[model samples]
Target: MTGTDAKDDLHQYLREAREALLWKLDGLSEYDLRRPLTPTGTNLLGLIKHVASVTAGYFGAVFDRPFPEPMPWIESGRDENDDMWATAEESREQIIGLYHRAWAHADETIEALPLDATGRVPWWPAERGGMTLHRILCHMLSEIARHAGHADIVRELIDGSAGRRPDNTNIPPLNEQWWLDYHDRLDRTARATRA
Candidate 1:
């Protein structure tokens, strides 16, 4: 494949992961969006919020194209892991808006620069701070995909919803009883391991 093709494929995958993460929030109430469904306080809105900040930094600051707005939660360190979740005052529109803007900024950077264009990551060790657009893209893609998986689990815990995205469930279309029996078989196998 050509260099451009590789970049496009990577960008497309990143975009899908970003959309999948955001899609998990649809039709949910504010309480449900912010409510921690996992033991580590993982929630739908928080996942989006955290990704926005990280995405902006990697695609914005890393490439010398800064995001237009200030992210005090990430920049100022006002609260620990503030980016990991949304605050009561932060509306759904606001966080989602920021994420969209970050995507635009990242896209511009990706478009303007070549795959080998060098950039420094300030957060990384001095010896390994320098990186290329391709490397950063791969890293961010992995990061977003991992968080998207987390969003999947958190959403499932909230309302028994499970899928790759809203339009694509990507799972076998089986009856409810089939799922329950499959789950039971897995449970029994897990128990048998310790017996």
Candidate 2:
């Protein structure tokens, strides 16, 4: 792909991944959002909260602009893991709303800078000599895709739902007997391995 085309592709991929991450949270109740779905305490709302911090930090604070609001615990060193798991102080609506706003702010940064425009990352000065807008955009896209994959697994565990995106409708319905057959296959695999 040409330079411009590749840049456009990166931006499009980022938007798609971010949307998929948010879509995974749809139709979930507050309790469902906060419920730990993995051994490590990853949950739907927690994923959204992390995205908000990363988005605002990388795109807003990195650029010397103001983020919309404070992440109290993150700012105060209450719990580092709070970034990836919901806390009692955080609400599903508040985190998700902040995430949406962060996206808008991040989009504006992407729009204002050309792919080759450079920025200084103060925290990573020793590692990254300087960073291009293209690099940051690509990195954010990968970050979103990574967390979205986590969201996909957690969502499926919650309600047996799995798909590439929210609008996906291509999954074939399975009957109870089909599930039994699938389980039987799994049992056979376990037995063979145990033996």
Candidate 3:
């Protein structure tokens, strides 16, 4: 299609992933949002923080736009994985606000540059340092979507809520008992095939 149409499509998908990730925070307490539900310490708020850093870097520094805020967690000489989780002092509102701001900044970069406009990713290896706005969009879209899936599982473990989004679950209309039975069937089948 036209250039505008292609850019809009990519932006739309990126927005969808962002919204899905944020929706997981709804109705959750600060404690619940920060609780490490998985063995790897995958918390809801942390995912938001991480994605914000990611988008800000990809769409900002990579494009030479530079998100207007300092991200100490991602700076050189910081503890490894600092961006992967929020500190105890960091409130949900703070992290979420930064995420929203990052979105706005990234949007500015996306709007100003054509999809084929080139830039260098300083953090990337030499062979892959050169990039285009289109490539960054696709990469961020995939990254956000992958983390959104993680948020889905972590959210389900917390409260039994599971869906693509609030308005569109896209899952079968199965009752709790039906789901339990479905899992039971799978369990039995796996057991039967065990070596």
Q: All models: lDDT?
A: 0.92, 0.82, 0.95
Tens digit of lDDT per residue, candidate 1, span 1-195?
A: 999999999999999999888889999999999999878899999999999999999988888988889998976648789899998899999999999998999999999999999999999899999999999999999999899899889888888888898677887889989999999999999999994
Candidate 3 stretches greater than 4 Å from native: none
Error of 2 at 123 (Å): 3.2
Model 1 ranges off by over 4 Å: none
Candidate 3, residues 62-95, lDDT tens digits: the string is 9899999999999999998899898989999899
Q: Name every residue pair that clashes in candidate 1.
A: none
- The number of clashing residue pairs in each candidate reads 0, 0, 0
The number of the candidate with the highest lDDT is 3
| Comparing 1 and 2 on TM-score, the stronger one | 1
Q: Model 1: how far is 184 from its true place, Å?
A: 0.8
Give per-model CA RMSD.
Answer: 1.0, 2.4, 0.9
Q: Looking at candidate 3, what is the lDDT of residue 170?
A: 70
lDDT of 2 by residue, 93-180 (tens): 7888888999999988878777887776666765774778788887789898999989888998899777777567345677778977
Residue 85 shift from truth in candidate 2, angstroms: 2.7
Give residue 86's error in model 1 in angstroms.
0.7
Q: Which sequence of candidate numbers ranks them by lDDT, best first?
A: 3, 1, 2
TM-scores of the candidates are: 0.97, 0.86, 0.97
